[model samples]
Target: MAGTTGIIGGGIVGIALARALSARGEHVTVLEKEARLAQHQTGHNSGVVHAGLYYKPGSLKATLCAAGRVSIREFCEEKGLPYREVGKLVVAVDESELGALAEIERRSAENGVPDLARIDDPSRLREIEPHVAGVAAVHSPRTAVVDYASITEAMAQDVRMAGGSVRLGHEVTGIRSKNGRVHVTTPGSESVFDRLVVCAGLQSDVVARFVGVDASPKILPFRGEYWELAPERTDLVQGMIYPVPDPRFPFLGVHFTRGVYDNVHVGPNAVPALAREGYRWLSISPKDTWESLRWPGAWPLAKQHWRMGVDEISGSLFKPLYFQKARRFIPELKSSDLARKSGAGVRAQAWGRAGELLDDFAVDQVGPVTLLRNAPSPAATSSIAIAEYIIEHYLVKAAA
Candidate 1:
């Protein structure tokens, strides 16, 4: 812990870790592949700071999200950044979804989600979200949103102030352990650090393989596409209107989000991306696609969730299908309200050989090289807390 630390990936989690370590007097350097930080998942997310709604009680997601919300809120206030506690309502659109909604409420309570309210009356649900349609809902008034990209940049500033270095365009090509030190090679640069932490986002497994690690828990990129609401129709949503996510899948079904900028968008229908960083359907990578197809878990995963995959793909290709799904939660929602395809973000979801989605935060160590194999979803919302968790559980042991 007293030595220099080199962090791979320049997303919020990696930046947060660098800041924490730097503040503790550890020499830190961040290597970002892109020209800037947060170019991938961090900058391309919904921006909603989660409030421990759907995660199981006592999970890292549940615990860290609770703590990280407060951390992010404080960070925003201290930096004079925009932080909106716009609240979130997980609605049960019909009687059938009530069971999953109830489970969410229970988990929220167990996770100590602040000021969680269960609304059974339709009128009460209307009071929370005027245009929303739902039989019952679980509302968390403390749920908030912030610009994670801005936060990551601010944290990088803190790292620099604390004598840390952030190097952009430093794509790690190879990694090896030499003489008890980790040597990371970029195209034109060869650098050794006392410790190296791989938070390499989409290329986590690829980087791990450089150190001769197992590729079992592979990254399966799933693209979440969003459609922006027309400016005149933004008022239809007050805060966030989410569906009772199917417990069978890790993805929370497509819902409405009133962003911090006050522009409401509906979307993020999860579909298999042809590339690790695949944003649009046309942005396909043949090698990435072939590797995914060749994975042992690929068949089992497809077999289990092929229907959901087809439905998601259908929504992705056709706007009308996507509109129908959105309109179910808001009766007044017009197909025309979805003005244009805003953008897409590919989530680097980790899956096992048996086709099991690694739902929790996962870490692996090969000597001084610590690979963050899986850090999805609330990883951004729980960034600072994740830094602390990683430091306490992994870094300290490695340093000693």
Candidate 2:
């Protein structure tokens, strides 16, 4: 609390944390490997500001997302950024999904999702999403979308104004703790800090090892690919249409989202990536692939989810198969409506050596170094609140 603070990773979460710490008069410096911030998961996402519909009640995700969305709205207003409440509809296409949909409704209610409504009548569902096909659905009118990259840029500006340095292209290479000081090394640079917070999204686990932490929670890069709706087809989705997700899988299945810019896009089918930064199928890293395969958790995780793995991989490879998944929500959808592959993001999904997904936000500390072990999806939504939580529990209170 008394010396310079180093926050690794230049994504929204890291920048948000930097903004907070700098405002508190902590000398903060952000180290990002990319030439600019928001180049990874922060920039390449569905851009939906989640409404806490899927997270477990009383969980960190639920608590932070509830607070973070409000904070994000306020921040957008203050910064004159685009914040559109396009709403979200989670549909149960058939009776088989009704029970899962009901559980989501229960969770949403307990999580206090604003203006959440359960619709059993097909007509009511049509009123919200005219083209959506579903036996039942839940509507969240307050669910919104924003330009996260823009938001992150604004936060970075605030950090600079508050006297913190946002250093782009400064990838962290090594870290050493000695005599209560953290020594961080980058190519052609070395810096010492009183406290270090690692928010390295994709390389978080790798960096944690640099701090000499356990390697149990390994980062498994899961790539989510999306497709753009044809210009004429964008109107088919009024806001966002989603499926009642499979509880066993950590993904939300392929869905339609109307971005803050008013462009509708489909997908983000989850698939394993060949590299930690793998976005496209051709962007392969033999080393990253080998490491993931060699990890103790990899085989068990695959063994448990081989069926889902096969399904997702098939969808990733075949447009027709992917179209079938999306057409479940919108029966009128044509295969051609999926104009082209728009973009993709690699998620740094963490799993235990025992083959279980690390669901909640996890934080670990090693002396003066604090590591954000697992923070995916809703992490951008919960960034500011997460920073506050870390400050209170890890930094400020720890100092006291």
Candidate 3:
């Protein structure tokens, strides 16, 4: 496979790119460290197909997400997968939040979100979500839900059907560029590729450094913990209930999500992780922890967002507070409505040296290598469009 295109990471973005390349008659190979695909971020997210809300106008995230949602829905329909457009309500509980809600409406309109409406009548809002309490709300009727991990597996199958290999458990230990070829070394063997794309979510910066790229923006892992709604209280959330997000932070505040399978999930509070892959408070890695501390940006970022960070961690440590925060959206939801804590995912958010978290997706190319430097929240929603963007702008242009 010396002349093949190599892609690292088996998550949705990597697999989606592999499918796109193979569809174009290009020989592709995907290398994953895990034993199976979609074991991390792809499988652990809230599974909401964003309707292009909350992104800055004219940005890659805004454009790509707008296109990607349509692409995902089409793909799911073709593959006979579950794609439910149950809709979402971004609620504002008080007069103070109405301003933010209006801003979100403006951004959604700028991004071409279809059928978005501002619901000011509380009774009308209650008709959409019987239990949700908000003075005003932004109803996104097109916002849908799908199982991303299932979609990833389907994409992996397409890769194999197109004669490409999805090699699991193939951890990339080293990467070097020499004489116009990239050599990727593994535990048992090494393979050379004409071009390489790295989508190593948690270890993105570390992987980019293997090819001698600048490592200024380091990856800071933030764990998002969630709780499953009890079976009896699943009706508490009609579709998806979200709060008016704080402009200062990139994360959407804690809310209720009705998954494709009809299970309601309440949570995903963002908390600082002790390690890059740490999903729980007890899961610690000394090396990862030290690297975060050693970076110039980490301390300053902590200093800037310490209050929110402390609140998030406090929510994680105490279920009552977490329940209270979530209750803001659906005022009738009770502590007993939550079952045992569900799964958690670690976000590989990029932080620059200036202590600012990158708010958009970033891609960097070094000759034959394309590295995804920053891809968060909307990434899963934007994976397909991102693949098209990379191929049309980078791969196709390079070949020309």
lDDT against the true structure, per candidate, is: 0.90, 0.92, 0.90
Writing each residue's lDDT as its tens digit, candidate 2 over 61-124 gives 9999999999999999999999999999998888998899999999999999999999999999
Error of 1 at 56 (Å): 1.3
Error of 2 at 228 (Å): 0.6
Which consecutive 10 residues in model 1 have the weakest lDDT in total? 246-255
Writing each residue's lDDT as its tens digit, candidate 3 over 241-323 gives: 98898865647488789999999988788987898888888999999999888989988888888898888988899999898
Candidate 1 lDDT, 1-400, residue by residue in tens: 6777899999999999999999899999999999999999999999989988888788888888889989999999999999999999988888998888888888888999999999998889888899998889999998888899999999999999999999999999998888889899999999999889999888999889999999979999999999999999998999998888876564658778888889887878899999999899999999999999999999999999899899999998988998998999888989999999999889989999999898888889899988899999889999999999999999998777
Reference-based TM-score of each model: 0.99, 0.99, 0.98
The alpha-carbon lDDT assigned to residue 296 of candidate 3 equals 90
